[model samples]
Target: MSLLADNGKTSNCRPAFVCLLLFSLLQLPRPQYNLPFSVLALFLCGVVSLSLGQNDKAQRDRLIACLASLILVTALLQAMLGFVQALGLAPQTYGWVLFTPGASDVMGNFGQRNQLAQFLGWGAVSAAYLYATGRMGRAATGSAVLVLALMMSWTGARLPLAYGLGLALLAWFWHRRVPQDETVARMARVLAWSVLALALIQIFNQQIDSVLQAIGLPIHVQSGSDRLLDAGFGARRRIEWSKAWEVFLQHPWFGVGLGGYAWHSAWLEAYGGWPKVPESWLFTHSHNLIFQLLAETGLVGTLLVVGGLLCCLLPYFRRGEQTVDNLLLISIAMMLLGHSMFEYPLWYLPFLLMLVIICTLSPAKGWTVQLSGRFRQVLGVSAGVLALAYAATGILPYRQLIQNFTPRNENTLQASLDNAKRSLKLSELSRNPLWSWEADLGMVNYLQPDGIMRDLQLELAERVARYQPFPTVLIKLSILRALNGQAEPAKQALTMAIANYPDYTPVFQHELARYREPELKPLQEMASKAVKAGAAQGGATEAGRLAAVMTVAAPATRQPIF
Candidate 1:
């Protein structure tokens, strides 16, 4: 239990060093969207590690308890928020919670159901930790479990349920095999409670909904759980995973070069003749974490990251005993990692932070650095200051950019244009470079002029498409190209757009129909052909064939402009 013992060491260099190397990977990309998060993680690890190294066993336990409590409280608050949202007691807004509109989604502040479910699972685990360790009372633990179950059910995500059941079964088997490990028994019980809670919710979810409706409360329409057994439930993820695999194959070495999944997905669909995703759905990630890392960072990045984790965990492995603390922490870490296998949970900063903290806290004993008490104090203060500075310089500017670009009633056309320009300027100093492309795209939309300005808009659209490759941008770029009398390239862009969204031909035709320009006729003809092909073939096959033919006929240069 004594993290530092009488060794009087004030630092653990191995973890801090490994953590620094691991987080530094976040800065490998030009955009560095996760740079601010990386810095914050470093600061947190340094402070926590230093604090533990200076404490005795009792003090260390208290500090760890406090940290665990903080995580549990945050997760509990999110669960409560989700519960309220499920009951229609709060306004779901962009500034606060953004539940998917008209769906039975309850994401709290995480903005996605699966992510929220994983976070709530962390809460449930934390509650079990507190209860098994005699920190939380039985009643409080039960209430937390019940609330988490209801919220998890409302999210309508089934993967977490499966994860819970799987973990529970593993815990039971471990306990049975060991027979002497109290930690395994306690963990098994905790997982059993979670599994039971979720299973009960699934069984009675309809009754709960009916009761709420009968009580005159307006509940949002629920997505049926029957979809969990549907054959096509994960079809989208399969499509995205296939696209990500193709991207990895093409890049191989450094992969697509960080945060480039969307860009490459667009490029592949446009040029590689891949199957088109459903309209209105954009795959920002490959859904699976391993595939995403392979597509975005490739072999080198994945090895560095995976190797760093192994290095950090080596001490625990070498210890060879499953202590209660180790089991608890490993269970929590495994929940996140297991979820990563199915979905990109760690992409969000909070989940990433949790993983970092768990890693930092896991190693019981390691190479220690002895420092004077005064020196340790100075180090802690320096880390705090550095963390504050990084947040101010990086996160603040990013926040401002979001606010500026986010539409409000006062944001007129000119105001919106000015905000986009300002956002572009801010991106230079901000840690996030992705927003720069977004700002440029906004300018392309807000700028309304003729002649050279129109040409500038086309150029901007082309530039954004290289990085973002969003369907709308491709369509707009095609229209602009046609207006500029570049009919062939225009058709190529339209073909790529249609290829990415083959089933959306009617919508594409409608957009083209809105334009009175004679130059748009060919683009309309292409969309109409795709629609006819889709109708004749009855799905993706015929439409995909047409898109392939069109792509070959007007093949745009394969070289990426970015």
Candidate 2:
């Protein structure tokens, strides 16, 4: 119900009031009080974890061990999937999985190589923890760790290997400090196995492709493996980090707003002269949690979060002895924490939930909150029910939208249009209504007459731009303006796209080249001039380098602008 108050304005409630104050201090626009789905997940998971934390140590350990076993098993399965993909044997479109799983893209159902690698790293940690606690045999733990380590290497993400090395050293220290503890000794052995796997993979990566070729596998592992050879961090990450820093400087005290980085980054590229990322690349997060928080929440939110983390750690730091159990738990949680420094694994619900649970299990040095059993039950049930209810609210609209937008026979056009209307109406109940624009666009294009279609599309495009401001939105707006006999506005919009996405000049040319419509001739001419101007600047190759990181295949619109 609190989320219902987010109508693009600050609410009088405590959380909303705090958000309003933060936005005011940051000099950003009036804050929206909408609660994103992640917030609810975080709340519910925290409730569950805190409740678990209050349990007896034996009960808690049993639960933790079970959770760790689940993590290890999940990771092992994903690792096997990744290995299949790398071997060029994965079937396309298996069940819910999409994407061409070839050697260059070993996603393991996560849809991203980096994310797959990080999750596998977490699994490796779990396997170690399980072995150290005598829950798993040494042989099984060793096999799981080896497979996970090998798959992580094949994913071509260097950060996990680097993180593994650092943690391996820490494990060694723990083993040395507590030489008598078999748990520490076993964990150190697992860490050593991971390090050895990393080293073995590095040495044999170049030859593995040749051997695969000998076996007639169509794909070679060379593409992703080559990334491992380079020591420098990616250029795209550097540019993103740099832009995030500039945003921090602009609003250092507060921030643009929570979840504002992507839109603000788009706005900056279009009008604020910020260095543009690759075409179609929207930086949802800065790729670094610290930088993202600094850019989104600024110093105030950063301090609050960091200070809270420190307070949690202060208990461990002040302890007279750092027990191996505590260190092991911290190490397991550190898998996600270290990954957050390089990637946004926590953005995914499973990883975030796991992190919350692990942190809850970790012993914090502080006064304990001794809630009565009845109180704990009430709190957990209330939070879980609220989260479940909020989640269910989106299901109907999402289903309707999916059904409404599915490709249908021309005979069912009227039915599709009717369903689109119903879907849009249902979507109003959603806190995030941006998705309704798709149905609106579909209805406008199909139901509206030719005489008004262009005008309605223009209006819709403009409205979307107000919220999104992506380059494609600007280009679509330009195309619509040209189609509507407003050439100047069209050119202005095209100019904005050119300025923000010069690397996309090739894409613009490709799209505009199909402009057989007489009214769109000016748009084609403008694109040509922009291309030539970009080439004349002697930066074509330089611009192309960034585009190599990520480029859109084409515009996202269903109907071609031409």
Candidate 3:
């Protein structure tokens, strides 16, 4: 393929612009999962529109090949890392291949296996593309098989591995049934040899455990087993699914609204408590994508999501163009389907991006060519706006990192520290923040001293009081005060929490235990003295004096102070 055709102009930048806009929208909150389809759709629209302006067969081939190669390389690297981790190597900090520990297992480190599966699916497609283009050899095919095997086993992501193996077997069976062209027949033989080599490696490897220990590493254990036991043979997911069905029954047309499932789930849990209801009744997710979509977006929104998927997949399937791109799209769709059986795959960014890339490569129908001069101008403006937005969002994490890492001794560090602390605090207040309040509270205790931490605790208590109906926040505030050695305040906060949530006996017991610690004696003595003084001045009633005395005296009878 030629780099550029004679008539094809390089000046048309609409495709790049559209991609930028779509990327920005994907970064938005609540409906973040829809970003991939949005990005892919916008990009494809650009590509199709651009293709209308000129004809350049070589350039088109080159562009497709380049994109295919990029996708292949990314997949290869991710697979390699997954394999290395599976072999019991700790994830490398500085390497071409990167793996992060997830969920106390290889799969957990990556947050979800769907992304890795999508990557492998794309890699398989890339390999298939090479074979279709008569570029794959026996050696290349063998290497690809080995890599795929490693990815599947090491990552502990069952879905992608299963899908890839199934597809390969189906392809082998189909190729055997149909009389293949000599070239395709040759490629198939090479693929067969590669599979044979992978089998040999597996045979020699013995136990997966022996291999890990031989390399001075311990075996990776997944939390899924424990979660399964806790959930009663996947009954937790079944419960969530049942609730989603009820939601669908209630709002069969338009969903309650985007991000509304968590709110609705409280009622569901109140009625059907199969899974042990969490102290704080928060919906992790619908756990089923289709159900989640139905519950969140309703029927009309579900249709849009379904339509987007069809628009992304139908083109390549109809054309019978089993190019690397088409394979990626199919694999991603399958992977999503698999992941949706257990997890809400759209929550993560990388998986979402994989979906977009796959959809972008899929063929579309009835793509009208309405590229007028004015429309082109709008495209340029939109692209510029998107570019700026992407830049801003990309920089936020870095800014936060800098603020978080600033030295405490520096004059300006206090302000930065305050900001970081406030960010954590605000996230706690929002209730639906990205992280758990326990985690945020831990950060505050670890980073700040006792005096400043006490002030923050007081502020948090006040904030929780304002949102009095929400007992979880109040419980957390009480815990924070208890940890900071503020017995009186902690008791007051716990009293409020117990009143709001009388059924939460464990929380009350936990706070009472903290009051009985010996380390709290100094504070208790001070509180007791203040109470007696107030009583003498007739400032405190008999009940108030008794409450104050109980707060101070209870710990003295339990344990000796250090």
Q: lDDT winner among the candidates?
A: 1
Worst 10 residues of 2 by lDDT: 1-10
| Residue 261 in model 1: lDDT | 87
Question: lDDT per residue, candidate 2, 1-562, as tens digits?
Answer: 1122112222112222223223334433434233243344545555655455554467666776777787788888888777677765666536544347333467888988878887787787778888888888988888888888778877877677676677777787676677888877887788778777766875687686677678887545543346756644455566566667778999998776666777556544444543444454455676777788788878987776555555444453333334545555566566777778777887788876766555555555323433455655566677877777767875875676656553343658797776556545533533355345455434333322134557766776776555455556767777777778888877767766665576776676776676666777887876777666556655466555334322322222221111
In model 2, how large is the Cα lDDT of residue 523? 73
**Collision pairs in model 1:** none
For model 3, where is the 10-residue window of minimal lDDT?
Answer: 553-562
lDDT of 1 by residue, 410-491 (tens): 5489866766566455445333453455566544444332355678778777777766666667778888898889999898
- Kindly report which residue stretches of model 1 are placed more than 4 angstroms away from their true locations once superposed: 1-11, 19-60, 92-97, 173-187, 212-225, 271-277, 311-320, 364-437, 447-450, 454-459, 480-489, 501-521, 528-562
TM-score against truth, every candidate: 0.78, 0.76, 0.59
- Regions more than 4 Å wrong, model 2: 1-38, 101-104, 212-219, 222-225, 229-232, 270-279, 314-324, 367-372, 389-396, 403-463, 478-525, 532-562
lDDT of 2: 0.62
Error of 1 at 266 (Å): 1.7
Candidate number with the higher lDDT (2 or 3): 2
